[model samples]
Target chain A: MVLQAAIEKWSGKIAEVTIGAANAAGVIKVGGQETLPFLFSEGKIPNAPRVAFEVWDVHPEDWPPELAAAWGENLKDPFAWAEACVNKYQAQALCLRLQGAHPDYGNRSAADEAKLAAGLAQKFGLPMIVIGCGDNELDNAMLPAVSEALNGRQCLIGSAAQDNYKTLTAACLADGHSIIAESPIDINIAKQLNILISDMGLPLERIVIDPTTGALGYGLEYAYSIMERARLAALSGDKTVASPFICFVGHEVWKTKEAKVSPEQGVIWEAMTAAALLQAGADILVMRHPAAIEKVKQHIENLMGK
Target chain B: MFIIGELINGMYSNIAAAIKEKDKAAIQKCALEQIKCGADALDINCGPASKQPVVDIQWLVEAVREVTDKTLCLDSSKPQVIESGLKAAGSGSIINSTTADPEKLGLLIPLAKKYNAGLIGLTISAKGIPQNRDQRLELAATIVSACADQDFSTENLYLDPIVMPVNVAQTQMRDILESIREFKIISEPSPKTVVGLSNVSQGTSARNLINRTFLTMAVAFGLDAAILDPLDKDLVDALITAELILNKNIYCDSYLEAYRRK
Candidate 1:
C-alpha cells in the first residue's frame, strides 16, 4: 500500500506588500504565500523573508557595550551608519528610527528628522523603513514631516496605533508610503488597527502588521502564539488579517539580560528570536546586530531550500 | 460563509422575462450585480415558467459565464437540465441539489464528478422532508456513503438539511440547525453544509428581518454555504456580522463595506 501525506492547503493568501519605490536600487516585497512558511511542497512561498538593519539617527547611550561597539563611531551620524549598513554590512534594507525626536532624547526638530530621512533614502537606495520616536505626541508631530519628505519614495513608515492612527494613515495615503500597524502583542488590536488604517482609504496591501515583538525567554511564546494565530486566520481566508508581518527582532532581543551576558550569546539570542519568528510567519525582520542578521539570513536560505 | 446568489433564477420576473426572450443582457446584468454584492457563486434555476429548462439553463449559464468567472450552481430536479448546464459550464460549477434517494444520487453524483463540480445533497427522500434531526442525519449518512462508494470526493459534497418555512415547520427549525452541526461529525474531513435561506421566510410578514435573523443563527450553527439573495443588503450585513462575531472574519470599522468588497 502507498501512503499519502496530508498537506494542508489554505483558501487565503497573505497580501504582498512592496516597501520601496520602483526607482530605488531595489524594492523589498514580502508575504505572497498561500501556505504556512517553508511548506514549499504544500503551496507557493513566493518570497523569502527580508532583513533590515536598524539605524538610529542619534548616537545611542543606552545600547550595551557589545552592540554599540559593532558600529563604533558610525552610530554618531545617520549617513555614516546607513552607508556602512548598505556598503559594508551588505544590508538589504535599512530601518531609520528617529529616536532623537523624543523630548528627553535630544528632542530634534521634525525638519531635521525629515532632512535626515530624505538624505539617507537618497544616499542609500535600498528600501527604507522610517520609524518615529516612541512618544505618541512626538511621533504625530514628526512622522508627517518625514512622510512628506519621502513623498513618492514608498518607504515603510510606521506605527499607527489604535489610539493615534488617523494622522499617520492620512499622511501615508497622501505621500504614497506603506505603514506598519502596531499592536501591543494583541491579535485583536492588531487586526482592529489594520482595519482602522484601511478605513482611511489606504489599501490593505500597503499595510504591514507589527504585532509587537517579545524577546526569547521574555514573552516570546506569547508573541509567537499571537503571530501564529494571526497567520492561520489569514491563511483560512480572513482578508482583514491577511497583511504581511514585520517583527522588530533587534528591538526585542537586544534588551534582554541574556543578550548582555556575552557577545556571542547576544548574537545568538537575536538570531534565535528572528529564527523562531520566521517559523511563526515573519515577513520582514527589523534587526540590529550584523552577525545576528547574517545567521538568520542563512537560516532563511536553508528553510527555503535555496 | 459561501453565499450562492439566488437572484438569477427564472422565478424572479426579470429573470423570467430574460429567459423567455433569451435576453442575454438582462441575465449578464443580474450576474454582475450579484457578484458586486459579494456572492461567492450564482445559483442558476429555470423555475416553473420555463417550458424548455434544458435550453434555458444552458443559455443562462453561457450568459453568466460571459460576465464573470465566478462559480455557477446549476439547479434543477431533472438530471438532463443539470447536465446541459454542466456541459455549458465547463468546470468549477456546482450541482444545486440531489435528494438522498439513491436513484437521484445514482444519476447526479457522476455528473458532478465528470464536470468537476461541487454537489449539494438534500437530506430528504421520497417520503418528503425529515421530521427531525436524526432523520436528516440518517439521510446525510446515506448520501455520504453513496459518494464514497462511487469514489467521489466527499470534500466536493455539500449536505443541505432542507430548511422549511418558519410559519409551517416552526419546531423543525431547531432540528435543522442541529442537523447542520451534526453533519460534520458523520464523516472525517466532513462534507460542507448549506441551506436554501429564503425558504425559512417563505410566508412571513417580516421577510427581510426573518431571513437575516435565521441566516445569522444558521451561520453560528456552522452552515458553510447558503442559496440566498445577496442583493438584500441588510441580510448580507447581518450575515457578515455573524461571521465576524464567530471570528471567521477579522473585525474592521467598516466591516460591512469590507466584506462586500472582499
Candidate 2:
C-alpha cells in the first residue's frame, strides 16, 4: 500500500500579529501560517519566526554568569544594552523586562518603570516588548502606568493572567497597545486567558499567547506539547486559540541548571530549548545571551531558507 | 457542530399539541429554550400528525421569528410546504431536506436557490435508504452534482447519511459512519455533512448515552452539522467536548461557557 501523506487540509490559519508601533522604524510580524511550520508543500507560512533579545531594567542577580559575561559591562545601562542587542548583535527586536519594580528588587515605583520603558522605546526605535516584574500584584500595578507612558508608541504589553487581567487589559486597550496573555502549562487555561483578554475588546490580532514553557529536561516536553497542540488547533480553524505564540525562551533557559551551573552547556542549552520550540510552532522567540540569539537567528533563517 | 435543534417538530407530544391548538406561545417558548441551550439553528417540522403541514410550518416560522432571529431549518417532504415555511421565515433558512430523487431535487433545489437558503440532501432516495456505504455514496454524489449544477455553493449543501437505529441494524451503523468521511471527497467543494442525530439511538433503552456517544464519534469522522436535541445538556456537552478535542474550538478554562456564548 502507498504511504498516506500526513498533510492536513486546514481551513483556518493562525491570526497574524505584528508587534511594533505604526510609527516605529520596523515591525516583527508573526503567526499567519496556513500550515504547520515548515510544511511548505501543504500550506503558506507568510513570515519566519522572529527572535528578540532580552534587556532588563534591573540587573538580574540570578542570571547565569556566562550569560552576563556575554554582554559584559553594557548590562549596567539598559539603553546601551538594548542598543548593542539591535545594532551590534543584529537582534531583530528588543524585550525590556521591568524587573526593578518588584518589591524584592529595587522596589521602584510604577512611574519610574514607565519612564525607563518609554526611554528604551525611544532609543531602540524597533519593535519593543515591554513586560512586567512577574509579580501578580506588582505587574498589575506597574503595567498600567507603563502602558500609559508608551501610549501611542505601540509596545507589546504583557501578561494578563486569569486572576488579574482587568487593569492591564484596560491599559492596553485604552493606550492602543497589544498584549501577551500568560497561562500555566495547561492548554485549556492558555486558551481561557486569550478569550478573557479578547472579551475586554483587544483584538485577537493584537494578542499573543505564552503557555509558560520550562527549560530543556525540566518539563520542557510537557510545555512543548501544549504549544504543539495549540498550534494544531489554530491550523484546524479554532479562532479562540489562533493568536501567535510568544515564548520567553531565555527566561526558561536561564532558569535551568544546565545553563547556570555548567558553563559548558550554557549557550547550547538556550539554543536547543529555542530550536525545539521553533519546530513545535513558536512564532516569536524571546531570548537573552547574544551568542544564543545569533545561533537561533541562524537556525530560523535556515528554516525559512532565506 | 452546526446544531439544528429538533424540538420544534410535531412528532414531539408537546409540539404536536401546540400545532393542533395553534398555540403560538408554546411554539415560541420551545424555540427560545433551545436557543438558550446553544442551538446554532432550529428545525421546523410539522410531521405526518399535522392535518395541514403547509400552514403549520408557516405558523411555526413566524412564531419563532417573534422570539428569535436564528436560522430556521424548514423540514418537509413537500416542496410547497417548505416554500410556505420559507416565505414566512423572512431570512436565513435551510431546506431540510431532499432525497437524491431527481424530481424532488428538481423542485427543492430551485426553491433553495430562489430563497438563498442552505440545502440539506439525504443519502436516501425515493427507492429507500441505502443498504451500504457504496449505495449511500452513489446517492450522495447525485445530490452533490445536482446541487452543483444549479450553481448552488456546494459548501452550503449538507449531506445527511441516514442513521438507522442500532438495535435492528448494527452493521449498517458502521457503513453510515464511514460514509460521512467519504462524503468529503465527492466533489471539489465538499457538501457539509449532517445527520438526524437522535435516530442512532431511537429504539435503544440508552437513548441519551447512545445519541451523545454516537454524535461525538460522527464529529470525529467529519460530521459538521446535526439535527438533535440541544436542550439535552449531556448531548450538547458531548458535542462541545468532541469539538474541543478535535481542535475545532480553542481550549479555555471556561470553554463551555465560551462556546455557548459564541
Candidate 3:
C-alpha cells in the first residue's frame, strides 16, 4: 500500500495588519496566513515574521552586564540607541518602551514621553511599536499623549489589559494607530482583552495579541501552548481571536538567569526564545541584542523559505 | 452558530400590516435591525395571511436585500412562494426548508441546486413530527439519501430536527437535542443542524429565559445554526457565551458586545 501525506485545510485566515504609515520608509505587514506557522505546503504565509529591536526612553538602572554591554553608552540617550538600532543593526521595526514614566523610575511626565516618541518617529520612519510603562495608572495617563504626538503614523501602541483598556483603545482609535492587547499568558484573557479593546471602537485589524512572553526554561512552554491554541482557533475561523501575536522576547528573555550568563549566552537565549515563538505563531518579536535579532531574522528567512 | 434572524416573517402583526400595505420601509428596517443585532441571515416569510403569497415573499426579499446583502432564507411550505423569493434573493440564500417526503424533496432540491443556495431539511414528513430521536434520525437519513441520489452536496444541507413547543411536547425536547447530535454521524461530512429556536418556548411564560437556555443547550449538542429573534439581547448573549465556553469562539471580557460587533 502507498502512503500519502494528509494535508489539513483551514476555513479562516489571520487578519493582515500593517504597522507604520503609507509613506514610512518601511511598513511591516504581518499575519495573513491561512495555515499554521511554517506549514508552507498547507496554505499561504504571506509575510515573514518581523524582528524589532527594543529601545527604552530611559537608561537602564538594573540591566544585566551582558545585556547592557551590547549598546554601551548609546543606551544613555534614546535617540542614539534608536539610531543605532536603525542604521547599524538594520532593524525592520523599533519597539520603544517608555519605562522612564514608571513612578518607580525617573517618573517623567507625559509631555516628556510624548516628545521622545514623536522625535524618534521623525528621526526614523520604520514601523514603530510604542509600549507604555508597566504601571497601569501611569500608562493610561501617558500613552494618550504619545498616541496624539504620533497621530496618523499608524504606530502600534499598547499593553492594554482587561481592567484598563478604555483610555489606550480610545487613544489608538483617535490617532489612527494599532494596539497591543496584553493578557498575562492566559489564552482566554488574551482573547477577552482583544474583545474589550475592540469593543471600545478599535478595529480588530488594528489590534495585536500580546500573550505575555515567557523566556526559555521560564514558562516558555506555557506561553508557546497558549499561542499555539490561539493560532489554531484563528485558523479554525474564530474571528474573535484572529489577530497576529506580538511576543515581548527581549523583556522576558533578559530577565531570565539563562540569558544573563554571558553576552554570547544572552544573545543565543533571546534568539532561541524568539525562534521557538515564531514556530508557535508570533508575528512580531520585540527583541533586544543585535546578534540575537540577526540570528532570528535568518531563522525566520529559512523557515519561511525566502 | 449561524443565527438566522426570525423577525421579518409576516406572522407578526407589524410585518403582516407592512406586507398588506406594501410598506418597504418597515421590511428594510426589520432587516437592518436584525443585521445590526448580529444575524448572519434573515428568514423571509409572508406568513399565512397573504392572498398573493408569491408576490409578498418577492417584495420582502427585494426590500431586505436593498438594505444589506446578508443571506436571506426564503421560507414557505409551497415551493412556488420559496422559488419566487429565491429568484429575487440572488446568490448565497437558503431555502428555509423541505420535508423528508420524496415529492417535496424532489421539487426543492432541484430549485436549491439551480439557485446555488443552501437547503434546510426538516426531519419530519407526511407522517407528521417525529415522536423520538430514532424517528427523527430515520427521516434525516432519508433526506440525506435523497440529496445524495440527486447529487446535491450535504455540506450545503442544513438538517432541522423539528423543535416542538415545550409547553405542548415537553418530552420531545430532549429528543430534539439528541437528534441534533446524532444527525452529524449520518454522513461522513455531516449536514449542518439548525432549529427554530423560538419553538422550544412557544406559549410559555418566561419565554426569553427558556429560549436562551434551550438555545445554549442545543449549541452544546452541536447545533450549527438557529432561526431566532436576534433582537433579544439576553438570548444572543447566552448563545455567544455558550459558543465561547465551547471554544467555538475566542472569549473576551466584553464578549457579548464583541459578538454583536462581529
The full ranking of all candidates by TM-score, starting with the best, is 3, 1, 2
Model 2 spans > 4 angstroms off = A1-6, A260-265, B5-95, B100-119, B123-193, B197-223, B228-235, B241-251
Residue A68 of model 3 has an lDDT of 89
lDDT to native, each model: 0.91, 0.87, 0.91
Clash pairs for candidate 3: A192-B252, A192-B253
> Which candidate would rank higher by TM-score, 1 or 2?
1
How far out, in Å, is residue B9 in model 2? 9.2
Better of 1 and 2 by lDDT: 1
Clashes of each: 0, 0, 2
What is candidate 2's lDDT per residue for B1-262, written digit by digit as tens? 8889999999889999998998999999999999989998999999889998888898889889998989999999888999999999965689998999999999988998899899999988879879999999999989988888888888889999999999978999889999999999998777899999888998889999999999999999999899999989999998999988986676667788778865
Q: Docking quality tier of candidate 3?
A: medium
Q: TM-score of chain A for candidate 1?
A: 0.98
Worst 10 residues of 1 chain B by lDDT: B249-258
**Residue lDDT tens for model 3, B1-262:** 8999999988999999999999999999999999999899999999989999999899898888789999999999999999999999997899989999999999999999999999999998999889998999999999999999999999999999999999999988899999999999999778999999998888998899999999999999999999999999999888999998897766655667666765
Residue B221 alpha-carbon offset, candidate 3, angstroms: 2.4
